[model samples]
Target: MFSLKAALAVPFAKFIVKKEQKWINNPLETQERVFQDLINDAASTAFGVDHEFASIKSHADYVKRVPIRDYEDLKPYVDRVVAGESDVLWKGKPLYFAKTSGTTSGAKYIPLTKESMPTHVAAARNAILSYIHETGNAKFVSGKMIFLQGSPVLTEQNGIQLGRLSGIVAHFVPKYLQKNRMPSWETNCIDDWETKVEAVVKETLPEDMTVISGIPSWVQMYFEKIQEKTGKKVGDVFKNFNLFIFGGVNYEPYRAKFESLIGRKVDSIELYPASEGFFAYQDKQNEKGMLLLLNGGIFYEFVPADEFFNENPIRLTLKDVKVGVNYVMIISTNAGLWAYNVGDTIMFTSIKPFRVIVSGRIKHFISAFGEHVIGKEVEQALKEGIEGSNFQISEFTVSPQINPESGLPFHEWFIEFENNVENVSDLATKIDAALQEQNSYYFDLIKGKVLQPLKISEVKKNGFQTYMKSVGKLGGQNKIPRLSNDRVIADKIYDLNLIK
Candidate 1:
């Protein structure tokens, strides 16, 4: 029955794939259309009127009128919308507010308009459809699929519903897949992540689960729970499980551990979803980067990452983006975000079809000693260091140890190893060398005797998990930072005695 359903869906999936290729081929034209639509639609809104969106003719005019803003900068307008003001940001009050915990700002409420909400659902659906079109594997669609996400329960502020982005997405799951979705609503609503995972393991253990999706770290906890309960590999328990859908963090670091936990490899899809917008997803299995959603209801601007902090940085449209250059992505969306800085930095791996890899966050970097180390550099370095080696890392984070109470200041890497290494110092040396090779400033700092080699502080078993739980960010789209500019996280980990 399931196989027949999958067979019937193939043609429809292919048709959608063919339609998507149109915008993919003409990226610039599609973006221009989206830009014009956003401007015309929101011209009467408070933000648009204030920025003279009616007079904006080109990208140049738009740039000249609207300055790039982060969430805090746009909060005043958002506050009006929250206070039930119509036509403040968008044409009308938002349908929902994606409530997320912000670093500087206590909590951020990103608007989800009627026009914008469907785009999120469509992007995710299209990702799966594209995968099926490419691989001819829609069998997973018929089988039970588990999405480890936040509670669907939402609170009302004024007249709009508010919830986590993932939670809001839950309410939008297609009707066809509702029957095949795992973990009961009661189980999902359980707020405690550990308790929820335990419930999910019990519910899914007896089911024929074919697809599992979540952030890798949280999913790792789920996988471990399954292993503990069954005393068998995840693959042995769920033989049909073949599709792993993930986002929030890079999967390369956890690939080895995941494979070990499953006792085999599985096809995976990487999605680039956020509260701001659903930007991109892996279109092809062998692709290096995600296919950027050019036709999505969002207009994009890219500023060179190096010059992003400048008084007046050059903001280039998709047409001007170059391969291999790090760029800070800015967006103007149908949801009424105008010239908003999403805080993520990306690099174009392919420009012909416009594919991008999320390089790092604009703020999540270690420049404590002027080395300017970014997330991509650290992840790549760790990946290189562990390749072909027996060292399997569960989780890790890096921070600058400036006043180390020892010799010269250095990078402190707190890593939770999946398996014990023969010599941790050897692993640390390899990682440090890789980091030095990737970051020239760090190399010069070390060579000039201003900074010492990076050190590894072994995190006790499940230390990262304990640290996350302690801070009330255990799961549900929460992720550990790969790099921190300061010792805030590092100090917290030490205070908890998570370091071995």
Candidate 2:
């Protein structure tokens, strides 16, 4: 949408360019003005739906009155807009739908639009530029980079299908950059996500590739298959490739495993892409990235994560954010998401142009048992415990499940113990202790902690990941989201001894 429709947006984009000039030079300080402008814009074109924002006459009033919204709340608005109603929530013909495995629900089909296309594009370019600015490296501008993205060849001309976004990009990418794109058409379908990936293997393995990008899990899978096929590993194939860029999810759990498998040093790039919009990215020098919103395309709002959002929630400006506190990223985008919560919680690491770290998903918390434990809280506790106790943990999965017999829900942590000569219980106690000290909520509400005395399961040699992978999911993006806060997947996961 960004590159292909460059012509249509030139004039409108010029206006956007003019508006964003002030913030363009690091605009985190102008949050209040941006947030108001965004709300006003949404009110003016409330999708032709009988929606809340449609009747708003003043942007200020709308901004003052409207409550923050989540995906589920917005889903109804999306349904109306897609069904051909004009509402402030949606506008124009949907360019297409971006398919996502919804955090709460299993799948989410979000509508993309022409108006919002630039937001995605600009956010993307900004990420690249921001990375270059951070690292003082302009090598990307000269080299051939591979985006191991989904197949872009569309089954229909209308970009309304699940694969339409990827498909359209392939068909419309500036012809010059198209050749460098990775992943053949076969690997980009909903019919079988892996089948399409397999196709990318056949086409890319024999080639001399310099730079590669993709969801790390799939990329790693391809490398493993390549090694199995030719008796040579990732080091053999990617020795010459200088950089690896990936972002749909976290790679921290697999960072060491990947480095070991590749047997070479590769620059790793992390991206935080949203079908709603491409929000931020990681740069080389700063492990944390400066988030340059499609500042020109959409307006942003920040709500403190600790406060009750449904009640009298405090929405702050970019200037009000502290360096380490979590805030729910709300944006009123060109795509008709007004005061829409993107389900991500990021903390500002640096205020210069607002560099932040994606701490975790707001919904990625596990409190199925009434003990509220968030991903960030758990990660922090674990990191603290590791440092304090000097216990090494390779990877772990925290799932909340209801024991059929106990009639009470509990948090089960499938922990992967590192090579240590001593006791597993000691480490478990240390972790629990850390949590009590770090986050009191979890400690008070937690009923009983069950630590698997055995660190290794015979079915998988290395970690708890083998069981998750065996269940047909990518290690990076499709992690078993912690906050089922329900017993659904948790029970199923518990029933099957992942390793055995």
TM-score of each: 0.99, 0.78
How close is each model in CA RMSD to the real structure? 0.9, 6.2
Model 2 Cα displacement at 240 (Å)? 1.9
Residue-level lDDT for 137 in candidate 2: 46
lDDT of each: 0.93, 0.59
In the range 349-447, model 2's lDDT, one tens digit per residue, is 777666776767777776554455667666665565555444445556566555544544455666554444255556556667777776666666543
Best by TM-score: 1
How well is each residue in 332-410 modelled by candidate 1, as lDDT tens digits? 9989898999999999999988899999999999999889899999999999989889999999999999998889999
Q: Which stretches of candidate 1 lie over 4 Å from their true place?
A: none
Model 2 CA lDDT for position 43: 55
Estimate candidate 2's alpha-carbon lDDT, on a 0 to 1 scale: 0.59
Kindly report which residue stretches of model 2 are placed more than 4 angstroms away from their true locations once superposed. 1-37, 47-60, 86-91, 103-107, 133-144, 151-172, 186-191, 287-296, 368-371, 380-395, 401-410, 415-430, 433-437, 443-477, 482-484
